[model samples]
Target: MSEIPVTPLLDTVDTPSDLRKLDQSQLRQLADELRAEMISAVGTTGGHLGSGLGVVELTTAIHYVFDTPRDRVIWDVGHQAYPHKILTGRRSRIRTLRQGGGLSGFTKRSESEYDPFGAAHSSTSISAALGFAVANKIAGKPGKAIAVIGDGAMSAGMAYEAMNNAEQAGNRLIVILNDNDMSIAPPVGGLSSYLARIVSSREFLSIRELARKLARKLPKALHSAARKTDSFARGMAMGGTLFEELGFYYVGPIDGHDLEHLIPVLENVRDAAEGPCLIHVVTTKGKGYGPAEESADKYHGVQKFDVITGAQAKAPPGPPSYTSVFAKALIAEGERDPTICAITAAMPGGTGVDSFGAAFPDRSFDVGIAEQHAVTFAAGLAAQGMRPFCAIYSTFLQRAYDQVVHDVAIQNLPVRFAIDRAGLVGADGATHAGSFDVTYLASLPNFVVMAAADEAELVNMVHTCAMHDSGPIAVRYPRGNGTGVALPEVPELLEIGKGRIVRQGKKVAILSLGTRLAEALKAADILDAKGLSTTVADLRFAKPLDVELIRKLLISHEVAVTVEEASIGGLGAHVLTMASDEGLIDGGLKLRTLRLPDVFQDHDKPELQYKEAGLDAESIVETVLKALRMNSVGVVEEVRA
Candidate 1:
């Protein structure tokens, strides 16, 4: 085991109450200890490191200044709440962060009383804090709601909507804008810090308000002049005047790293009787660690690493990842076609669109954190006869369903949807898992939904969607590496709404979808060894349902089973509905469906998560035996074979 970091001050603090017991002068040392502790814990556990490191001092200051548990502190996105976790009595288990039976990567309301609200998605903190504030006001409670939102999250419209409505809880709702975004980082050059001080000062706000009121009372002709003068002056004075106009008493552009600055400002904000205050505290994404600070991304997320050398431990190299395959495939198609372009929602790198961007910078569009706009923008591009592939993680794509339905599907635009992370993503937990995309997308008319069983299939799907001009088509692939299948030099475009039988049999057949084909094949082997002839078919298109192939299998095989990586309403449901409608299953053939369990499975190793979800080979074999009522064979023993 590695050497655990020494933190004398941090060791004394079990909770925020323990932190508040110390003098204000001791906070700097405490913050140093806290940051060190967080680094060490993340070094061992390997989760979100940079975001939490950026907020160490801010976390310390907030916990020390405010009475938490009583006063709700909701962390936006919750990846940056590790320091808060360390301070809030969960320090003992901090080393187990993001492990199967340990602490979650993000905030969970069940984890501790300190976490008043749970969050994994972005831009939800402000709205949740507003809800808490309004509830407290109605109940006449003494609690105050504080929302710590990041600058990148500010790009989403939901945050602004919450801010606009926060005027009702004057002084009760506090928004701390953690400005770590390189785009929105503090203004560069010419005494920016000094200007921030001047703007945050009482005099500047008073003068700005006086000017606004005077302009309102002035003649319409002169009102425009006054407004322009005020805008120019305020823009020159403070960068946060835009937030002020949106119904927040804006403060700061303050230094987030300095405990001296953060502590005092936080204390004042807590004591003030102001409603809906937004404090813009500028912070570096990776504050203390040398390698993280030096890196372009600040090492936002990392695997387990060497703390001293900052060298991350690499996983054993295998096949090219599904994301890389998708990128390469997209780039190949883009090279062939001039009209092909790509759009991503804030995550150019995560969705592998950055590779495409590198090749086709003129055509690639990164629309920031706005998924809603990304969908509609792709629809517009497609409507104009351009083939626009909108690549987004499946979980994140849920935010733009309205746009997908109303803008893309309704209009039958040929916008291609590349949904990455389309299954149970480990470590990040259920919030990040892409479980419902097939269910939701397959139901939409004029929308073609497909899930890839391997990297080769993913390439075929990509090529197929690129050529597809009939309607909006989506291809969802899992989070990790491919299944080591040999890649085609140029992918063969698959016929839309078609499936292929991988193995042939007579007694029973397994219809597989997504990446579950491998497990089905394994199960087939076990079934063959048990003297039960088994057939397996990979159903590529979830929406179209390859009805002809399904009907033939249902008639030939005495038992039929459907397998998928999604929820109940996905591939299995579609197959069952199609089979029933066609009267293919009325001949008393046994039918079973394998899917993720009804409950939300917690974070674990991917293999273990699959086993728990009953989607593994053993589970499939067991399901087959149970459905067949094969009492003659030792089902459990046959699976062991």
Candidate 2:
């Protein structure tokens, strides 16, 4: 393997205190070095790229000015914290960016003292910062709390709520609105237009200054009228007048890229700030780099790539990804049915719906990081005799759980949920893993839950959700490529609450759920070679489980094993509930459950993580064999391979 490159300036700096020692000119150099290091690191590790590059100078300025560890600096969403991590004593281990046992891709409070409040989701920084500000006030501490949030994050309702509450509290707080004109996807909605008006009006600052000066110099008797006139004119010139009404002292829409403009404005805001303050800084996404500037969204989160050609490291040829399979199936179904429409919260490309959006522009909706709004919007469409598919990642869907239960489940709307990343995500750590959706969604009253055995089954699930108008239906799938199966020309909907036994044997029966069917098949093969015949059945639906088929297997086979990709309170737990309710345990049928452990799994290769969790084929076979041996079935000395 080639040796890693060295970073000199990055190596020398360990903390924000070390950054404070550098002069303004050296700080500029440090910003350049930081950007280069970020690009280089992401080129190897494949994570968020453009946002970090855009915020390089801003990050440097903040660390240089603020006394961090004393004055808390919170990053909203934290996808842009790569530069912050490199400068804060973590440069040496930067290569292991999102790997297991390595540095987190986002800010983690447990990782370092510099990260006071950790965040992986968006629009949370302002709320967290406000909490710190309130706590500091109660403790009588002389500390400043600043929240650096992107323009896109500011559109969320929670952010506005924090701003309103912070203004009412009358506490000293700073909010830096980084206007980059991009989220993971380009920002949508009315807030985006308001920000655009502020950026386009170049002469807003000079005009506001002249009006303020004129208003102050007026006669004492007519001062109130003069102040009102100034406020009206200022509102007309700069578009941030709405913020003033909310009780926040509104500052500039300044040039963020220019250090000369940013440094002095920030210094003034830090010194003169009393109540809540908002400093609007305009910056370009992927500011300095040519390639990233041209394709900001493509580079938002990436894999290892060649810097010169900007080509990502190629994976060995595999089957179509689970996302592509779903997209293709949805498009096929859309062609057949005109009433079907698709919606995504902020992830069109990530959810593989970009092609569908292009083909059916009028039918697709990109709702922009608002999962709750997306679900309710889908519910509205479903109420009007339209079939709506709301495709979102499992982790992000957690944000809208209440909406799903109230708007969709309670109403029994026929909104189709296409949940992506339904298992252990390889990187991005615990915050991004899709482990809890099964347990959480199953608890809701009127919902149908299903999981695909493979890529071909995922296609059928899409067709099933599109056709089923009985109630809300959800299909969960994993990340990465599929099993290279030949796809069917037409999708066929399977019977609901029914399961198929793939391999029938006499001794033991293995019932698997979702993507873990392949592991069960492998374990069956291992047991077969040992003269211990194993039956494998795919329990397609988790909510309304095939109770009849499970009872038949328990009666015919001596031992039964339940396997699932979720945690303890998931499919396996539901099976145990069924057995206890049906009084199947009194029949002398031995049962063992294999699932992801209760604790959170750290970042690692997906295969290695499964092995460690004892959910792999070898581990499953070992677990089942041990159970059989303990039940007085003679232990096999060796399985014939």
Candidate 3:
């Protein structure tokens, strides 16, 4: 085990109150200690590292300057909030992050009062902070709302929408644009810091306010010209012309790492009687750590690691991840079809669209953090006689539901949706879990939804989706590695809405969907030992139910169970609705549906999560036995080989 870094300055600070008690000169040391502690804690627990390290000084300055809990500070996306968490009385449990029954990796409202709003997804802090600021204004309160948003998150339209409506906050809303990536402005230096200080100072703001008052008396045309002149001059000095036009007093392009630069600048913005302020602070991701600074992704998300060597623990070699398989298959498909193009929304690497993009740069599109635009863009591409595959995580696809329904589904476009991370994500918890895609997408008209049981099935499904040009089609696959099945050399275009029986029996029938097929097979072995002949069927499509196969199995078998890895209103709900509509339940059918629970699940190991959700083999056997009215277990020494 690696030794934890010494954090004597951090040890004394229990919360932001303790941080505020320290002298201004002591803050630099505090920030260093905070950075070291964050790296050490993340080294043990393994969560987001780069973003948090980037914002160490910024986090300290904000908490020190603002009266937090009373003054709401919302960290956008919350990947950079680990340092914030440590400063807000969570340092002791920081090492337990992302573990089952431990601290959450992102900011959670339930965890502490410091976290006014919880966030895991990107591009939400500005809107949430606006809400907080408006509520305080309406109540005639003294609290300010500060939103610390990254430049990457700014690509989303929602951030601009919030900024456009920010004038109403009236000196209560502060937006700190953490410019870690995408250097939107010239390099920050002494001159830029001096300019930031000058613009944000109370005297300069008061003079500007007087000038604005004096200009109002002039002709409308001159008044408008005067306003543009002031904005344009500042825009030239600092790269914030767009922000100035959006009704914000823009002040920055300052060094985010320097406490001297950040503290007074934040204090100035906090005290200035402006309508709203946008502070552009520049910092490097993985600023302090050498390994992270030198790495390509800046050691963005890491596993439990050695602090001294900066070496992460690697999992034993196994089957390729579902994401990699999908990427390879998409690349293969793109090679065959010239019209086939791939699209992703700010998740090229996560969804494996980066590989596809590398193969065919002209045909690939990585529209930043804009899921809605990505879907509509794919729809447009499909309409223009091009085959477009929108590769996105299932959880993120929820953001573009309106586009999916209005643009693709309504028009019946042949756009293919490659939904990745189709089920529970172990460390990211409920916010990232792809629990509702099947329910949402499968419910839409002119949409065909399919789930892959394994890597081979995923390959076949990708081929089917590529050939599917009648209407919108989607294929969902899980996050981690696939079951070690042989990949087919030639991809097969499977018959739509058809299911295959992996094993045949008479007494018990298990209808499985997605990755739960393995559990179903395992349950079959257990049932067979109990002298109950069991059957397992992998029903690939969720929207177009395998009517003939499902009906045949239901009528023939005494006990039938539908198993899927989705939430309520997914495959299980659809199956029940079908049985009810077809009068298949009139004969007192002993049918059961197994799926994710109604409530949100917490972060845990994948196997434990499945076990807790009652989607494991033992749970399947128990559900089957309960349905069969078998109260007592009958153990048999001799089992079928």
Q: For model 2, how big is the CA root-mean-square deviation? A: 5.1
lDDT minimum window of 10 residues, candidate 3: 631-640
Residue-wise C-alpha lDDT for candidate 2, range 443-516, written one tens digit per residue = 78888899998999999999999999999999999999899888988887888888899998999899999999
TM-score, predicted candidate 3 vs. hidden true structure: 0.98
Report the alpha-carbon TM-score of model 1 versus the true structure: 0.94
Flag regions of model 2 displaced more than 4 Å. Answer: 1-11, 168-171, 182-232, 630-641
Instruction: For candidate 1, write residues 1-641 as lDDT tens digits.
Output: 24688888888999999999999899989888888888888889898888888898899888888899899999999979999999999999999998999999999999999999999999999999999999999999997899999938988999988988889887788999998865665444335545555554556556766777788898998998877676556555666667767778766677887776667666666666555788888887778888877873647888898889988888899999999999999999999998999999889989889999999999999998899999999999999989999999999999999999999999999999999999999999999999999999999999899989999999999999999999999999999999999998889888889999999988879999999999999999988898889999998999898999998898888888899999889988998888788886777878898888888889998899999999999888888888776543744333343
Query: What are the models' TM-scores?
Result: 0.94, 0.91, 0.98
Error of 2 at 382 (Å): 0.5
Instruction: Give Cα distance to truth, residue 284, candidate 2, Å.
Output: 1.9
lDDT leader: 3
Question: Which consecutive 10 residues in model 1 have the weakest lDDT in total?
Answer: 632-641
Per-residue lDDT of 22 in model 3: 99
Q: lDDT of each prediction vs. the true structure? A: 0.87, 0.82, 0.92
